[model samples]
Target: MTSKNRDLRHLHEFDAERLITLGRAVIETETAAIAALAPRIDAEFARACRFLLNCQGRTVVLGMGKSGHIGGKIAATLASTGTPAFFVHPGEASHGDLGMITPDDVVLALSNSGETDEIVALLPVIKRLGVPLIAMTGKPRSTLAQAADVSLDISVDKEACPLGLAPTSSTTATLAMGDAVAIALLEAREFSAEDFALSHPGGTLGRRLLLHVSNIMHTGDEMPVVTETTTLREALLEMTRKGLGTTAVVDADNRVAGVFTDGDLRRTLDAGIDVRSAPIAEVMTRQCKTTRAEALAVEALSLMEDHKINALLVVDDQQKLIGVLNMHDLLRSGVV
Candidate 1:
């Protein structure tokens, strides 16, 4: 058998109950580790947040091994959450990428043992340049912590690994601590949702926040509109021409008076109304739902859901007809 098949057979030796126990043990261990970190967000954690907040230059994250992987994610989270930050591998730092560090920048070094040679080697230079150092280490007394201006301890009671050799619980704790720091800074800055959306312009939140009704609403001739004195047949023709499933009926001032929809047509026919000869105002539903052209498309969506509607007429402050938007418009614009 191939090596992969042999590995699969070995994995099959452990039944469902054994697998569940193993998975649960790891989850419980990590859960406890994260829970323990709550109490440790003490004065030192506040100090770390203050340092990052005051940083005029970007926060440079440094790490080695598994800590490096976690540090990269921490840097990304910080950058995306209004704190400008980036990651630099310690091994690469020793090999001349150290030039990326500037006096204006703050260094956040990560090491579970706090004694990784490459990270430790950069300490003297970091100090020489007067760069503030924030160390996240399991060992508070180790070299990295001693060299830092602010040391936020990420100590864990035990590893989730069965052998207690792999970095599991400790890494999870460090990641949680990093998130806590980034979020604290984000709140301190009072970072607005618009500011956050600016940073994530390609994300779903950006689409929802940046896209306004004016950008997607059907305007001018594309909007289905008719006068209240118009015949029901003419309104139906207008609805068919615009293909919006509905048409707005306007009064003498050209402002919306009511709406004539497919549902109105059905009820009108059942009541034996002569659609070809009856005025639209006689059978249309008055006080129809409407939206402003300046509103967000997401707000329009909420209006649709709250009122169980699929479309809305866009109006101005004076209640004058301006445009029309439907669920299809939102979907087409990637706002839904």
Candidate 2:
């Protein structure tokens, strides 16, 4: 083939090569940016964390376009991890959303050039509220950076875009920096999962970390109960009906006096105990490990782990069986 013909015919290959080059360049740039962040962890970062930590009101995150997308994610991460935060579109902030900001709140603004007009336009109003401004910007000398109480530099050497127009490396660096700030603040505050559940009770983490034994345990009439005078056959029927693999034996007062499990049944049978003639109390476990209904699932996990058991009888203060929890429940709920 002729030289011009070869060039035109192989254009697709050239384009593919160019795309690979850009992708690698972006990855390498972001890797260098994240690495450089180690040296940039200074007192300003500490000040930012302290500012956000001491903030009595919400954290309002602001940015435009690509930065706005990243800002939204940062806000979500902050809100989930213990910081009370939400994202506000810079454009909307000027029109009416500015009311969301309070004097006690803090602003985390993101901008690659540090001169996004929409975000910059809200700076004065944020200042008027006496709220602290923490800026994440690539240009440290830009107006937003200069006005910030703490400036995080997220500069990148070049964009992966051949024309240097698309926000590739700079946005990546900015996102990493935002996460760094949020996580540092989170750890410094010693935020607990219980605290996090307060912010995200509707999600899976909330269900795992926040849901207690009481919330999901089989309670009331669903509980498997057998009196001390109940026959072994009667106790077995109750266990089968409850589908909990165990039964709680009660006294005249309906207190949980003992527990009988399939394991105990096996041992009793191995000892040649006549189930037809014997009472259920003959094979029941007196003083069984019981948990309060309100106990956290995580606490239940600890209990199961320490006892090497798969189930627990949940009881109230009076030792009346109120509910039951098993390993399967914890596993399904992701508490274990």
Q: Each prediction's TM-score against the native?
A: 0.95, 0.80
Instruction: Please write out the lDDT profile of model 2 over residues 151-191, one tens digit for every residue.
Output: 98888878766688999878888788888888997898898
Q: List the residue pairs that clash in candidate 2.
A: none
Clash count, one per candidate = 0, 0
Misplaced by over 4 Å in model 1 are 1-9
- What lDDT does each candidate get? 0.93, 0.87
Pairs clashing within candidate 1: none
What are the per-residue Cα lDDT tens digits for candidate 1 across 1-336?
A: 999999999999999999999999999999999999998899999999999999999999998989999999999999999999999999989889999999899999999999999999999889999999999999999999999999988999999998999999999999999999999999999988988999988989998998899999999989999998899999999999999898999888979898988888889999999989999989999989999988999999999999887889999988999999988999988888
Residue 111, candidate 1: alpha-carbon lDDT: 95
